[model samples]
Target: MSDWIILSTALAGFDHAATKHKVLATRDYLARPEMFRGARPNIINLSRSYAYQSRGYYASLLAAARGQRVIPSVETIIDLSARKLYENAIPELEDALNKGLRGAEGEPLPSRLRVFFGTCIDPRLERFGRLLFDWFRAPVLELTLKQGDWVSISKVALLPFSKLDEKGRETLFQAMARYTARQWKDAKSRAPARYSFATLVDANEALPPSSIDSLKHWARIAARMGVSVEPITRKDLPRLANFDALFIRETTSISNHTYRFARRAQQEGMPVIDDPVSMIRCTNKVYLDELMASNGIPVPDTVMLIGPEDFQRAADQLGFPMVLKVPDSSFSRGVKKVASMAELKALASAWLHDSEVLIAQKFMPTSFDWRIGVLGGKPLFAVQYLMAKKHWQIVQHDTGGKPLEGGFKSFSLAQVPPLVLDTGLRAACSIGDGLYGVDLKETNDGVFVIEVNDNPNLEHGVEDAAEKDEVWTRLTNWFIERIAT
Candidate 1:
């Protein structure tokens, strides 16, 4: 429910699945993944041991592969297994331990505190237990405490399922009831999605590439296919390994967390949209311009400026009314139309300080620019992005940097001009086989690729208007296919 859940379906066998949640053996879960395919099952692995590659470990691991939700997740079990793996959390956990120890009459602090779903036998330690469970979401945790001026969590590890006592059993159920109870809370369904995807969006972003409602709509379509979609933020980077795939909804930049997130997901071997390679290539206008030109793709007459020396040549070649661009510009921000040599020289002087290279190209004015949505090397949707009223770009920025956008008209792929579709596909393919919005200018001169966007805008009613829900369905299917493969 919050921004981060450093937090699925398929369950495996448990010698001790005493709670109401469903349980299946690890071997059975691995062998019969299809049985719970559409059920979107939530698995609580109660295996006897969770050692490396143990049945418990395999159960959680395999459940994740099939897009089922399981706890303690594979990442949870692994991170909690070793001291070095979770060493950084020790200091924070220690603080929570002391916070619980304060205002205590006490029967003397126990060296070991047993926590069941954030519940504890010692009522004083309940606050510590909840915080511990929040950090590490295993059902049962054993905290090895060290007492001095304050009690500290010296060592914390899983209390093996094989050693649960009768009282421990009671504690587990009570804590679970409190955790899972639907009463007096938001009544929501746990209809297990067939698969799970994490779409990264920045909470504080003023203008995100995909709106929250758009992601929810995609999530809904993904749900119908038994794929669970959850939105995650930067804080959830460590949680990437648990999902089947990842989709980035944030406006991406090469130096930002979005790029790091893309890299992390790819390193985890998950199907990640807006992959890092796409980000690098798409973010630099210099690279993209050269790439399109080298590939024999049609582009505007363009020149690159490394410094002032190339200014006159660029002006002479492209003339006035040229577009000056910083290499890493996006959403039409670092792009400007210079009407005279004075404007070009003034803007280039200021912009070239940060960037080593600037792109100078002929300004081709059109009422609208064509955008083709390409995923997996194919066209998904096409739209005519009408220029902002009395503005030269699809998006115009105010003094406060708020974006004023123009209207759009979505068209079926078949309705798109053949040259436009061909050029769009070529430009997108040159980047990578990932989701992209290829921007092209169609004029009597021909359809010329303006640029390709790694994280394209997938607005709800706008991009999906022509294809209806099929636009989202195709996106979901792309991820599902990649994950399945």
Candidate 2:
């Protein structure tokens, strides 16, 4: 229910390390899974559990197994447990955050840069994100390279903000300073407005939340609304401080650059949509499930599965005709429907291999799922996402796993069902007073909150069908108000 930092030390049992810091021993955390089963906590597992099955190893493993956001995850432990796996295996985790070294000297480095989320600020670092696209799950690694080989790739402790000791607090601030040290002062001529903002987007994204044409439309409308809007991408991190606000049009995730941009914008006192808090709350379904329940919002019968041991529990609770999902998946990518234990086992094993915890929910078939867009703690617009033809979900996949989305019909606020609108508002309010798309299933039984999305799609036709230009104006106005405050 609250933020906690689990000490990596091996105490005899779970006891308070510092009453004020909410720090606990590793064994205590390992012993109590129920304490965190339905709570949203940013757990920093400081236990150095490199051994195959030591107390620290079990602490990290169990924390992840219980679906907590941990640093040295199971895969990290498995790799480190074996020299053949860990040695020479350059950690690709931190590669996304830091790359493109010109160094103190003007000499170029031997290694090339990568930019998978989007292009880098420096064109020389374009290849950096791709080089780290190896899907190494051990996140927040500190990488140092020499003339030939990488000198070191060490895991940095993910300390909870404002809850660290003096040493840990210093480390956190220094790391943040290093990340936010650079600044770009490129100037551009533009029309005058009360303030300026950058629309962060990715032209190369296959299924971006907003299209280039849409941003252009919003920009034209935004100009008349007393704010200058320009399009930028991951390449514009250094130049971000120039703007008064930031609107992220690309999909966001904790592990990617999108989150970094939001964090930086927030750090610089800029009003940002898909703020870091919203991204953290919206991206993970496991957290949403817990949040919805804690707030007494209606959701389908759900079960959290840590491993095969929880298989029987899911079957007994949700039974056949249940849905399985990877917590962090989006756009119906990691979701699947199972009718028997055989299917559940096959799919659960595959998804759990990559993710720490999974979800099994009672299937609620609906004609359409209502997407109520909430901004600044108020309803912006509403739309119905029709189920794909003869499919159970809004988006169905072909034999090759290609996504085919269903049709959507927008709605005026007056026309939306009271229960749907009320449920959507309640769900979004639980997350934060930011931009959210609350998905709810209005079935014959009743209305149930499906999920609250941070960056809900505001496409040209789909979202604007009912409100038209009102959507963009309201969105821009939200930014103007935030900037004024």
lDDT of 1: 0.76
TM-score of 1: 0.60
Candidate 2, residues 54-118: lDDT per residue as tens digits?
Answer: 44555554554355655445444444433333333344443433455434233444333222122
Worst 10 residues of 2 by lDDT: 184-193
Candidate whose TM-score is highest:
2
Q: Which residue pairs in candidate 2 collide? A: 8-47, 14-28, 113-127, 113-128, 114-127, 114-128, 114-129, 115-129
lDDT (10s digit) by residue, model 1, range 248-333: 98888755677777766765678888887687668767667766765679989988676688899998999889999977788888
Residue 162 of model 1: what lDDT?
59
**What value of lDDT does candidate 2 attain over all alpha carbons?**
0.68
Task: Give the Cα-based TM-score of candidate 2 against the true structure.
Answer: 0.68
Indicate the worst ten consecutive residues by lDDT in candidate 1.
1-10
Stretches > 4 Å off in candidate 2: 1-194, 399-402
